[model samples]
Target: MLVWLSLVLCYLAFLALALAMPRHHEQLRGRKPGRGLVWLLRITGAVLLGLSAWPALIWWGNPAVAVSSWLGILSVAAFAVAMMLTYASGWWRTTLAGAGTAAILLLVLPVFLHP
Candidate 1:
């Protein structure tokens, strides 16, 4: 469906953003990024963003699905905000935590609200 496709695209964009963050940070600092950290950042960011956006596919169905879709959107937005903060300040941990929390909430909230 279109929702699923959009979710995929959003996640891929997040992945690219994640991969680029470290390089951006390094450039800001006039140095090279640590390779291990860059890989970790890219993988973690992609997983978190992908999971957060995954639920948006629920929008295609019932009220339960709608709720799930909304939650996904919320999580993705939160992750984006967190990423923006990291990009601006070069603080990675806090933003990563924010993204993780948002993703977890997206996975948990739907079950409680719908059932």
Candidate 2:
């Protein structure tokens, strides 16, 4: 589940970054998002990039596999994001918004719900 969820978040970040570009910007969010949304994309992209490090550091136990893991996650994330954005632009925005919310919740969940 974490894998799938992570994929969604990573892909969301990718899509956000793409939408930041003017050519594709209007295709996303039903309008050209203002500076705030662009900043959100950049910040969330950084956050998700950092989040990718989480699984890498945990599963690999150090700098050994971190790069590979991060790259692998990034590659898969980009591919999935491109496909979705190309074939399902209508659903992409809403799904990304929802998944982005879920991703942030998951990230902060332990802080609030931990024992």
Which candidate tops TM-score?
2
lDDT for each residue of candidate 2 in 1-115, tens digit (9 for 90 to 100): 3444556667777876887766678876667778987888788777876776665566566676666766777899898778877898778757777877877776777578768
Q: How far is candidate 1 from the true structure (C-alpha RMSD, Å)?
A: 7.3
* Per-candidate clashes, comma-separated: 0, 0
Off by over 4 Å in 1: 1-16, 19-21, 27-31, 48-53, 61-95
The parts of candidate 2 lying over 4 Å away from their true place are 1-5, 101-115
Tens digit per residue, CA lDDT, model 1, 61-100: 5667765675676567547645664665464545445544
Worst 10 residues of 1 by lDDT: 4-13
TM-score of each: 0.44, 0.72
| Residue 11 of model 1, lDDT score | 44
Candidate 1: residue pairs that collide:
none
